[model samples]
Target: MLIGGILRDSSFFCIKMSAYPFFYPMAFPQWKEKLLYWADSRFSYFALTQGNEHSYPQNPFDSCFFAGNKELSENDLWQKRAFKVGVLGYDFKNQIEKLESNNPEFFSLPDLCFFVPELIFKIDSEGIYASSRLSAEFLSEIETQVIPETGSVTCKISPQITRESYLKSVQNIQNEISEGNTYEANFCQAYSGEFETWSPIAAFLRLNQLSRMPFAALFKAKNNWLVSASPERFLKKSGSSLIAQPIKGTIRRGETASQDSENRKKLLASEKERAENLMITDLMRNDLARVSKTGTVRVEELFGIYPFPRVLQMISTVCSELNPDTSLKEIIRATFPMGSMTGAPKISTMKIIEREESFKRGWFSGAFGWIDESGDFDFSVIIRSIIADSEAKKLYFGVGSAITIDASAAQEYEECELKAQAILELLRGN
Candidate 1:
């Protein structure tokens, strides 16, 4: 840490860049204007700020920007997207002179872990970011130009999500599985028209319009790197220990306060829900143990019931102090495609999902965050996000809950509806 140039007195606001540094308060009115104006000229830039809080400076930094991560070709898998993670900011300022003494890859890194809470940091300009205050009222200036011409086709919700269709789909998945097919294929449907849009910010408001969970974020790690409002943490690293909190079960919030309390009570006692939550929790524990000390991996919390605007969820935290020699990338390689996103036997589920799903997930399920020079990192699962290829001008996000025999399609669909709230509202006029 640079004691001299630190964004003094600001615990959570600090940039990793020494050249074109960025550090700001929780809410800044004119920050975005300055960024848009200087982005082209700066030796470096940052996308900082958090807007998912539903509070001041409405526009928070949630964009992923870096020439390092962009696709230069139409045929490139990541072309037009900046979801490939990288280390950014001035965390490496002092390390610059010592590059000749260490492995370059270690010096320059992928954003595989998230540590260091609150302090603003940036690296070589690769990682997820968002502009402060811009999102607060971004729609006012956003006029839909014709959806840019695209090789990818526009999608529409043929059967708008309703209790009926959602339940049927669940039955369909179960029937297919009973036939010995697969477990969890992330089946997602569209909810928009060619001209109509679902603004991400608006959807965030509508769904999370109520949430009791902490650490929600609307992150733009880059364009393909976006999370509308993710309320859970996939993994974290601190000292020798690694932590992961996977949210498994969910039930819509009740219509009345008393009803809501009852709903929470039932969710706590649901055997199937608890089982599903534990499976993922165990999976996460195993993932962390890969880089963690033997016998050190343990579940910190189990089936911890949490409240969200739309539903009640069961989240469990699994932690293990990392092995001394472990690398951040190895930890991610083993744990990513988080169990919450992919079902048990992750590798098999991923294969099933890739074969069945029509679109490439891009950064959707991938991790996004900043890893400074020290390998200290922070990453959120890519759920509740909008993926866009600016050159082509298309966007995508999906909502799904885990499927179990006892799962109800109606409630799951409602859960999905709650998930899409933000994006749906943003497209209001479009």
Candidate 2:
């Protein structure tokens, strides 16, 4: 099965780069601008930001930037091709990640396995697409220019747990910490409401513009749409080296320039934030060690403070040398539903989280990214994101913070708001 835009002109370059049927079109310098087009013309669409906004010769063959629409569901048969895109729901942890989830589900994703998209478009200076045969009218419609505008779509957002309830949950987690059951746990809450006419494409565009995160992604599969501006990279594989940058600490950005600088410094100097970031970093290192060569797991960066549009985050990069024979599935099994999202003593903490949190996380904290045929992959934590169910007319976003021994429940609640600010504002047409 094939997909993509109709070739308007033979001048639009084409290259027989591989054994598979593909076409390389050399038009539209900015591939992201084509998202609305694909989302409208095809049933599946995915866009990964490569952070190449001003770079020249932007279409590198190995560049991470890619957009595509699924031709059909190959089900679990993803080994045939090097490329597949989809979400791994949180519940999948019960089977693959070796954790149990007995809590009832509030929002569930359709699939946990990789999906082979029908039409894959790799974004570069020249975009790549599968050959298609659609009507000229439809083709023209897709190619038409879109003047981006923030839609005035509003939805009533109510937290699943009230402030008092969240505080009580935090205290419960601290009790577990005090009991030595777990060192830290991530606590999250769901903010959801109905927006029957919400436009995913527009919301994603505005969200991305507001916060151009390193791992930003916009994905749509059937009725579900995910718009992410996540800065934490769950896992990335390049050749034999594996990298996971887990983010654990966050502070809201300051009001003024000096204040912002001071906030960054404060985060850098905060023992609490550093301890939180260090724990997650160590957790990731241990997770990678499972699939990595013995003595290969190492922390490359620790407590590295990075400023975002809304918050200042402390991130750490953990690196390891992968065992060549390690399969993609094994790698994911060793480390998924990323530690940053799960917390330390993974299995035990997850059990506590399930018992405490009000809603099933679903895809909110799950990983999403591409896996090439060569077994190379890069996935980002699904944080700072919005999930919209167009069919159900409901939109949901989850926000959480790491709860440690010395954590303040009130402060943690505020952190969730800071993390959610951008998407919330975009949804409110702010």
Candidate 3:
């Protein structure tokens, strides 16, 4: 009754909450599934997840919010409005003057808008705490509502680019590096499939179990869904301090523990991986400098090796003190497509990427997360993700690696396959 009544209140700002937090005795999966079911029934909705059980500073909560009870995809998404929670698409690059996207707009999840959650939950070691500004009556109603169970999803996959074609594209990128057209380029391949059991919520839960990263997100707009398990943080703002962690180098994990340690060491010691990391780091610094106070941009971590389930990666942390005049538009204008997804000398490399890759990235390489009323936000790079269209029974996953001069065509192709293994395995209904 509270949701039924409060949702009609367009001027609704916040909900009334209890004097203390209520501890709900429920597992995270059940909690998440309930929220997913609630969101699926809403018009515009989004859920930003860390995917891990423990809470970290950057990812403190797994929050879900919905805007209208009806779906809308307006191009005015960039019109200088404050959006507390929403999803930005990869094709948004075309709106900027420097980048262009010729890829077909086959997916409907291009851009979405959602209102701040009338219901909010924070899960930590203590317990699940519910927070809301709505009436106590409404809170009680939500507490009593029962969440239904999710059924299984089935899928059959097909590659958009064959092994030979991906190899050829890698060769072409290497040739570009040789010609001095660009220092590095991120080359991607697409894999698509037909699904009988295609529940976005279920797929996301499985991906979360397989790869528990710091920056995971679930975005559902009508029939289109973006379920991601990404480890890369594109941007985060706390006061005037802005932070970004760009991942550059990747190598598959070993079958044995000893071998895995050796892989991490190898990635750390490799001059090639470090060079790639540094190149992207420098690019990020330059982009940040454009909106940052002079001489404020600095690298907090350099060539730090972080291990995932399938691979170990080289990531660098770059930070900057923001200039008071910098707007969200300026921040995005300077760094629309992140450097990790695009190689060094971003402009030139993006042009080469468009020419090389066969399919458009859609929302794969873009950023999405939450931005509050105070102008603070956190967004994650859209990698290690799957986009599904339940209506068409189609699902797509895109994988790519940063191609440097020292890169081998065969190894790069294999790297793409390694990166996609988790989601591919899930699609196989494992």
lDDT of 3 by residue, 249-364 (tens): 88888999999999999999988889889999999999899899998999988988876777888888899999995777678778878888989788888899999988878878
Per-candidate TM equals: 0.63, 0.85, 0.87
TM-score of 1: 0.63
Best by TM-score: 3
Clashing residue pairs for model 3: 15-133, 15-134, 16-133, 16-134, 67-115, 153-197, 154-197
The 0-to-1 C-alpha lDDT of every candidate, in the order given, reads: 0.49, 0.72, 0.72
Residues 1-430 of candidate 1: C-alpha lDDT, one tens digit per residue: 3221222233233233332334333243333333322332221222332434332111122332332213122122112121223222211211222211121111122222222222233321222232221232222222211222222223342223455656666787666556656554445544423323333323333333443224333333232223245666666665566778788877777999999999999999989789788878877877777777789888778988766666677888887887786765466556765778777656555444444443444445555555434455555665665544333335556667777666666666766777766555544422
Off by over 4 Å in 3: 4-22, 27-29, 51-83, 111-116, 125-127, 133-150
Ranking by TM-score: 3, 2, 1
Mark the 10 consecutive residues where model 2 has the least summed lDDT.
54-63
- lDDT at position 7, candidate 1: 29
lDDT for residue 420 in candidate 2, whole number 0-100: 81
Which regions of candidate 2 deviate over 4 angstroms?
Answer: 1-35, 48-80, 102-104, 111-113, 122-141, 145-152
| Clash statistics: count for each candidate | 46, 8, 7
